[model samples]
Target: MNYQTFQPHPDLEALIKCYWTLEVPAEPAATKQRILPDGCIEMIFILGDDVKRYTSGEEYILQPRAMLLGQISEPFFVEPTGVVSSFAIRFYPYSFANFTTTPVKDLANRETPIRLLFEEKLAADLEHAIVNAADTQERIRIMDDFFLQRLKEEIVIDSILKSTIDTLLSAGGSATTSSLLKGEVSKRRQLERKFSKQVGLSPKQLGRIIRLQTALKILLNQPDESLTSIAYESQYYDQSHFIKDFREFTGVNPKEFYGNDELALSSLIYT
Candidate 1:
C-alpha cells in the first residue's frame, strides 16, 4: 500500500485541506476496511478498479467513480475489488458549501456522483481530466485549474458559519456551542440551521469528530500511552467517554484499534 498527501495551492488553502492519492496492490484475501469520520467532506476520483462500500450486514454499493463523499456521522466499511488507485480532495467542513448550492445536509452519510452536484458536461470534463492525467502532479494542476475557475465567481461564505468552525478547530473541538454564541438562544438556533445547510453535521457532532481526530493522532504517535492518559490529553470527560467516542466513530475499542491491519489506510491519513 502507498499513500501520500500534498498541500493544496496557496490560493485554495483556506477551503481545501489537501490533495491525496492512494495505490495498493490487489490481495487475494482482503478484509473490509473501516472508515471513520474526520469532520470533512471529500471529492474522490477512483482511478483503478471498483470498490464496495457496505450499506448493511453483508450488503454493499459500488462507490461512484467521481463523487462527493459528505460528512459521515458514523463509521463504514469498504473493500477493494482489485488494485486500488484513487485521487481525492479533502474540503474543510464549512468550505464545501462555497462551491455548490446543494444543501450540505442532503449529502450526509452517502456518496453523490459529481453529475448530481454539477452540470453533466462540467462533471464529465473534470473526470476525464483526472483519469487521463499523466501523473499526480498533472492531476494537481488539473484540480487547481478546475477549482480556481469556480473560485473566481467569488462565492461568499457565511460569516457565522466560518467563525463557528474556526472556534471549534482552534479549541481542538473542545469549545462548547453555547459558549460560541455567548448563551444567545436565538443565535444558537440560527447557527444550527446554517450548520445543517452548509456544514452537514451539527456543531456538536463536528466537534466530537474533530476531538476524535486529536485523540487518534496521539494514539498513533504515542503507542505506549494509556487510554486514560490519552483521554486527558484529548479533553474527553474521562477514559470511558474517550473509549465510547472512539468506538462510535471507529467501530472498535482503542485496544483493538491499535496494531489492527484494517486501520492502515485510516492511520495513514490521520498520522
Candidate 2:
C-alpha cells in the first residue's frame, strides 16, 4: 500500500485539511481494513477498482468511482476490490458546508455519489480528471484546480455561520456557544439549526470533535506527558472526562492506542 498527502491552496486552508491519494497493488487474497472516525468528511474519487464498505457482515454498497463520504460517526470496514487507486479531499467538519446545499450532517454513516450533492457534470468531470491523472503530483494539481474553480461557483456562505465556525476553531473548542454567539443568541440558535440542516451534525458535536483533534495531537507529540496535564491543556474537565471522550471518539484509551499497530496509520493522520 502507498499513501501520499498534499497541502491545499491557501484560500482553502481554513476548511480543507489536505488532499490525499492511495494506491494498493492487487492482492491474491481478499483482505479487510477498518476505518475509524476522525471528525472530518471526505470527497473520494476511485481511480482504479471498486471499494466496499461493510457494516458488520452486511455490505452497504460498493462506492462509485466518485463519491463523498459524509462525516462518519462510527467505525466501519472496507474491502478493496483488487488493486485500488483513489484520491480524496479531506475537509474540516465545517469546511464541507461551504460547497453544497446538501446537508452534510444528514450524510453521517453514508457514502453517496458526489452528483447527489453537486451537479452531475462537475462531479463527472472531476472523477474523470482524477482517474486519468498520470501521477500523484498531477492528481494533486488537478484537484487544486478543481476545488478552486468549484469554490468560485458555490453560493455565498452565511456570515454568521462563517464567524461562528471561525470562533470555535480559533478557540480550539474551549469557548462556549454562548460566548461565541455573544449578543446573538437567536442568531446562534438559527445557526445551529442551519448547521444541522446543512452539515448533518450540530455545532456542539463538531466542537467536541475539534477538541478531540487537539487532544490527539498533544498526546501523540508529547508521549511522556501525563494524561492529567493533557486533559487540562485540552480543556477537558478532568482526567476521567478526557479519557471518556477520547475513548468515545477513538474506541481505545490513549495508552492502548499508543501500542496498536493497526491504529498507526490513523494516528499519523490525526496527530
Candidate 3:
C-alpha cells in the first residue's frame, strides 16, 4: 500500500484540508480493509479497479471513476477489487457545500456518483484530469483550478451557517449549539435546517465529531498522556464521557485505539 497527501492552495485551505492519493498493488489473494470515520467528508476518484463498501453483511457500490462520500458517522468495510489506485479530496465539515446543490444531509452513510450532485460531464472531466495528470504538481494544479472555477461559478454561502461553522471551528469543537446561536433555540433550529440542506450534519453532531477528532489527535500524538488528562484537555465532562464518545465514533475505547497499528494510517489521514 502506498499513500501520500498534498497541500491545497491558499484559497481552498479553509474549505479543503488535503488532497490524497492511494495506490495498492494487486495482491496474490483478495483482502478486505475496514475504514473508520474521522469526522470529515471526501470526494473520491477511482483511477483503477473498483472497491466495494460493506455495511453490515451487505455490499455497497463504489462505482468506478468518481464519487462523493458523505460524512460517515460510523465504521465500514472496503473490499478491494484487485489492484486499486485512487485520488481523493478531504473537505472540512462545511466546505463541500460551496460546490454542490444536492442536499448533503441526504448523502450520509453512503457513496453516490458525483453526477448526482455535479454535472455528469464536469464530474467525468474532473475525474479524468485528476487521474491522468502528468505529475503530482499537475494534479494539485488541476484540483486548485477546478475548485476555484467552481467557487466563482456558484458560491452561495449562507452567512448564519458560516458564522455557526466559524464558531464551532474556532472553539475547537467546544462550542455548543446554544452558545453558537446566542441562546436562541428557534434560531438554532433555523440554522440547523439550513445546515442540513448544505453541510449535512447538524451543528451539535458536527461539534461532537469535531471534539472526537481533537481527542484522537492528542491521543495519537501524545500516547503517554492519560485518558483523564486527555478528557480534561479535550473538554469532555470526564474520562467516562470521553470513552463513551470515542467508542461511539470508533467502535473502540481510547486504550485499544492507541495500540492498534492498523488504525495508524487512518489516524494520520484524519488528523
Report lDDT (Cα) of residue 139, candidate 2: 80
- Please give, for residues 94-167, the per-residue lDDT of candidate 1 as tens digits: 99998998998999999999999998999999999999999999999999988899999867778878988999
- Candidate 1's clash total is 0
Candidate 2 C-alpha lDDT tens digits along 1-271: 6778899878878768899877779887756665776667899888878888776577457877788888876566677778888888998766777788776767888888888887889777777777787887888788778778878877456666767777777877777777877867777778788777656777777778778778888988899999999999999899998899878877788788785755655665655
lDDT of residue 55 for candidate 1: 98
Please report the TM-score between candidate 2 and the true structure: 0.84
- Candidate 3 — which residues are off by over 4 angstroms? 25-32, 58-64
Summarize candidate 3's per-residue lDDT along 73-147 as a digit string, tens digits.
776667777888888899977778788877788888888888778787987787778778887679889989989
TM-score of each: 0.97, 0.84, 0.88
Index of the highest-TM-score prediction: 1
The CA lDDT of each predicted structure is: 0.92, 0.78, 0.80
